[model samples]
Target: MEVLERLFNVALVVATLRTTAPILLVALGGSFTTKAGIFNIGLEGQMLVGAFFAVIGTIFTGSPWIGVLCGVAAALVLAFVFALLVVTFKANEVVVGLALNILAGGMTVSLLKAIFGTRGSIFGHGLVGLPVLRLPNARDLGWFGQMISGYTPLVYVAFILVPVLILFYNRSRLGLYIRVVGEKPEAAEALGISIARIRYVSSLLCGLLAGLAGAHLSLGYTTMFTENMSSGRGFMAVAILIFSNGDPLKILLGCLLFGFSDALSLRLQTFGISSYLVLAVPYLVALIALFALSYRARPRIIQETLASMGRALSVKPNAATDAEKAVTRG
Candidate 1:
């Protein structure tokens, strides 16, 4: 009973971190695209493709680490496709992104069935999930061990990326160019910043990170890949990006919120609950956060609206007077 108590308490924290892992990575990826003036709704598809590739790679190479690399590379290709269509062909980004997501879902399902000869599922005789790093004699360290040292490699890597992205976004010249391009493409072009090149790079990097997020799910977190394994994580990332409003650090926190709810849902499942309800936890949190964010932004929006209305109303009298005088003269 003592052991059970400890495990339950500790599991929640671990689960929280686990939940945050994918969100953190994907949110950062979405940040990259949004910073470049692109709304990448394809993160879910990118993640799913990455997850599928990682599973296949793990099956072939028998190494999760190498599988992760392969997964990221696959995601990179998908990202490139998105950039090509939207940037080069001048395709509608919204349509292309949605289509890409559907394509990814279909492609993964097709490949899984074709390769594994399974329509809905694929499982190995035995599969090793991501390596978990634990502190030696961790119980001796008390809560400190639970707090700091016990986590998966991908979780640590995901957290490490937070500060790294912060530095890149704030301190780098390329970052400046990205911001400028997103804000004003004409201005960026005048400054000799290649908008297309910047967008392409950002898109590629976003896809790469989203792939990493997916790899975390397949190679590190689970044994196999199911259809649409990303399961709206990409969409959640989109909501997180909007809530964070381009702040990377805050975005990381937003991911954590989603992760916590995910952990809770899982814990509840250990009892007796509908799998569908368990799945809804993180998404429900995202929905609530989005609503709160919109509510907060409402005041600012109304202020802007009022100011615009005032300008239009104030302009009308003079314009009308000018027209009347012109009529009299005529």
Candidate 2:
């Protein structure tokens, strides 16, 4: 009973919010690309590059906001490269993304060694972490205050983006265009919408959000840059995108589910569970959620596949009839 109480307290909620912020930000960014028919597998690299630059900027500029800008800028540059390669050069996005992830890992480590002179992690006196926001008089509200207050500004930004994105997708012209481009590129192109332009825009947006996520990780979540500090949150964001199918509301729910598992894992560590088992909690939960989602959708997927096959078979006879009619006319 005590363990259950400990596991389900206000503190767990706070922890979940913190843990979810980075993943939520990345997922939100990926949602744009997903909606535009682009599968960006390079979120991990973008995030890692952003995290390194964020720390570097904070240490050099003495401001966390500048750090965030640096991080975003770096990630944007990478995103542009991704766009160029995939959109213009006709490179495979998945391969390019994977290469970038590897590059980011190696590049960051090299930069860490070259610039900071100490690695494996980098932290010192001059690094300025992002400030936390404390709502005025919120502490007086008991558990509600604890849940809502004391988060960094980025955390608030991450959550606020959910509704904003939902409105964008449902009510905005550009959003409609993106969806059209993703679902029916041929039709969009026929309507004079530039597929490449929409895709580039979506990729950049993904990079921007991913940059913010990385900045939050280094500046708000922790004031240090450890090697590979992103810790697969980028890939996790991709999973969320797949699970939610780019819907902002569903993305939020997925983030919360993963976040809750993460928090619970930490809480469980206090009960003397194996660290390895506890660490697996989030991924384990993710697999189960994915399996359940797949299982639930299996019937629909099979029906769609069979229906498409039926259409294809029907088209063959119709094509033959049309050819025969043309011969008869001739």
Candidate 3:
């Protein structure tokens, strides 16, 4: 029983932190774009670009930090393209997002084939994943200390960033504009705000963070990159964003839940569990979290839907047409 207890404890703490890092990174990205009234469905694609660049950079530069920078830069460039298509050109956001993902996947594969003469995978002369930096005095404090130590810089960055974000959103003029654009675009437009500009910046910021998350995967967590390695973590990040009720503290909590599930899967793999079931832990936990989020979000969603429906039904035909026109512009 004592042995089982220790094993479970290890799984809980390690898995939680492991899973939290990725989701937290993506959630930060999601937060920026959503706050600017743009739904970024291309986070997965941005992450892919980041991962590809990170691996290539590490191979060439022989340094993990350079790899991380390359990854971030690549994702940032893609983000601008996404903004141009969706925000500046007024293209269908969903369609643009889907296309961006396809573009990233196709581009990465083509590059892999062209440069390495293989589409399966590639590795360089140097191994360049990020190092694990453990907290000082971690071992001396026993189990709790061990649990909190050995996180990557990105993990610490995520936690350290909350206050900065809160202040950015609350105290800055830019924050006010972002809120204006998201909450009431017309009001922002009336005040001479450029909605497109705000959205472009937001998308760029989101891309930057998503890239960091990708870099973390390639360098921080693993020393290698695999095709489609991001899997569906981008989408999972979206679920976490919703589950946290837009609260930073809650976001951390949500991230921990995911991290724990992933960690548990690892421990299970070390034991006797089938590989298939162990791999399922991350997605399964995300699904459960989303379900819980839906329960909490349902009332607000229903209210908004009903109110919109009522307004439509009660409006004069001309007014209803105008409303539709306004939605199109927005």
Candidate 4:
């Protein structure tokens, strides 16, 4: 009991915030594409590209902020290509997104080899990581301060954007335009809204948010770039967006859930569990959540299936009891 309590402490909550920040940010970005009626699956690749560029930019400029800008810029360029292909040329979104992910994976590795004469990963001097927020009176605040402060700027920004985005998603003209464009392209067209333009904007915003996510992964705590470091986080974000249906509050809750799972998984590893099982815990939770969401989406089929299963499992009551109960009710 003591062990379990220690494992699930304030520190775990703090770690969850850091663990969830990247995916949460990426989900927000992906939500835009979802709302705009675009099926974007290239978030992983965009994030990978962003991570690489962020490292490179920091290496050259010795400024993490410059790295962030470069990361976003690189993601925007890729996003434009994606928008052009999918929006203008009428390419399949899933195919384009998958292709982009593959391209990013290959390209980042090749660039690493060419630029640093190394393969797989890169790290060293001049690659300034994003700075942690040091509270002015941390000691005075005690344990709560430890949990609340000391995260990177991006962490705070990601959380702050939740309310801001919720407001924008419901109230802003552009948000409404994107929704109309996605849900009813014909109506949007009749109202003089350009479907292609709205989609392009959506893609761009997704890329921008993805880039921030990638940058945070690479620079939030360490100035290092690893191959395939995103490790399916983009897919997780997509799944979350699907489950939430672009609802900001739901997305936030989903991020917290996934993030807590991830953090807990890591904590459990210290208790002598198998490393593989520990790693799979969070992914398994995500898969289950996604399955549940998909099932819920098909309520009629699920209800019928459950009813059939219940009937099959149920045993018949005694015939005498049934007769007596019926006669008593009458």
Best by lDDT: 2
Give the Å shift of residue 58 in candidate 1: 1.2
lDDT of 4 by residue, 1-330 (tens): 999788978899999998999999999998889999998999999988988899999999999999999998888888889999999999999999999999999999999999999987898966789998988888688888888799999999899989998988889999999899888999999999999899999999999999999999899945699999998989888889887888888989999989999899989989999999999988999989988877777988888899998776663446667888999999
Q: Write the per-residue lDDT of candidate 1 for residues 13-120, one digit (tens) a residue.
A: 877887789878888988889999998888888998989888777778788887888889999999999999999999998899999999998998889878878877
- What are the lDDT figures for the candidates, one per model? 0.85, 0.94, 0.81, 0.90
lDDT of 2 by residue, 1-330 (tens): 977897888999999999999999999999999999988999999999999999999998999999999999999999999999999898998999999999999999999999878779998859989998899999799999999999999999999999999999989999999999999999998999999999999999999999999999999999999999998889888888997889999999999999899888998899899999999999999899989989999999999999999999999999999999999999
The per-candidate count of clashes, in order, stands at 0, 0, 7, 0
Candidate 1 minimal-lDDT segment of 10 residues: 120-129
- Models 1 onward score TM values of 0.92, 0.92, 0.85, 0.89
Error of 1 at 325 (Å): 2.4
**Which residue pairs show collisions in model 4?**
none
- lDDT for model 3: 0.81
Candidate 2 local Cα displacement, residue 117, angstroms: 2.2
Q: Could you tell me the TM-score of candidate 4?
A: 0.89
lDDT of 2: 0.94
